[model samples]
Target: MQWVLDHLGDISSLGLQHIWLSGVPLVLGLLISIPVGWLATRTRWLRGILITGSGLLYTIPSLALFVLMPLVLGTSILSPLNVVVAMTIYTIALLVRSVVDGLTSVPEEVARSATAMGYTPARRFFGVDLPLAVPVIAAGLRVAAVSSVSMISIASLIGVSQLGDLLVDGFNRDIAGELFAGVLASILLAIAFDVLIRLAEHTLTPWRRVQQGGGT
Candidate 1:
């Protein structure tokens, strides 16, 4: 408690950095993956390629990718952009499949009815498909958000600051309190983001609640 109070300023700064690092990639990845995933559905041939490529990208060891990003992106080794780029790739890899699955899960009957009612492809997509797809996409976002929070700790390996720094700093100083603080902070951050995602999901999917209420 005393240690935490003493380090409160550092903890606040690092926690905010963790949020920014994780949140930015999640948003950008979802934006990019939605269109790419939609295009994959339109061009069936591209679907396998996109999924496979993203899977391959995700399989790269995180530290190795961090090391590789500077060379590929021409950023300095210590730059936060490297972490952002790597995390964004990981976020896209995970969410593209989620997007594809969500879109595919939309009922064929709904799609057909929309078309029969003179809905253009774009209008149908915006009005019907995307809305129905939100629940599944939100599920993916929740998982990605939690994963990103945890992974930001790895960025501290390369000197990108965040709550992960607490672990590094603690280990160097051999202060058990700092090490415990880091672990607890990471867990709290993950849980906080998860709750926020669930709230967003609930907001976006009022019909799910309606269905449950009707069933009850």
Candidate 2:
């Protein structure tokens, strides 16, 4: 407690950096995943290739990916971009399947109704399909958010500073309070991400609330 108080400023700064390191990749990954996911739904062959290929990316060890990012991207070893790119790849791997599932979850009747109303492919996707798919996509986003936060800690091992610094520094120095603080902070950050995603999901899907209200 005393250590946390004394280093509150440092912790706060690291927390903000942690947010940056994790948040940017999540947004980027989601943007990229949407199109790829949509493409996968367009045909059987594409679905097999894209879903399997993207899913395989997650199997790569996070540490090895982090180390390789600089070589692949030509960024400096210490550059935060390496972490951002690697994390984005991870986020996409997790989300593409969710987007695929969510889009498929749309009722066939609803799709037919949209088309029968003369909605174009683009219009139906945006206005009818994507909006309805929010719940499932948001579930994936929540998982990505929590996973990104925890994984970002690994960046500290590679010299990128964040809350993971606390863990490394604490462990090296034999400071239990600091180590506990890092663990606690990471958990709290994950919880915060989960809550925010849930709130966003609720806002985007008012129909769910309406259905629940009507049922009661």
In order, candidate lDDTs are 0.92, 0.94
- Candidate 1 wrongly placed segments (more than 4 Å): none
Provide C-alpha RMSD values for all models, in order: 1.1, 0.7
Write model 2 residue lDDT over 70-179, tens digit each, in one string: 99999999999999999999999999999999999999999999999999999999999999999999999999999999999999999999999999999999998899
Clashing pairs in 2: none
The residue-level lDDT of candidate 1 at 57 comes to 80
Residues 109-144, model 1: lDDT tens digits:
999999999999999999999889998998898889
TM-score of each candidate structure, all chains considered together: 0.96, 0.98
Model 2 global lDDT (CA atoms, 0 to 1): 0.94
The alpha-carbon root-mean-square deviation between model 1 and the true structure, to one decimal in Å, is: 1.1
Separately for all candidates shown, the number of backbone clashes (residues 3 or more apart, or on different chains) is 0, 0
- Model 2 residue 76 distance off true place after TM-score fit, in angstroms: 0.9
Clashing pairs in 1: none
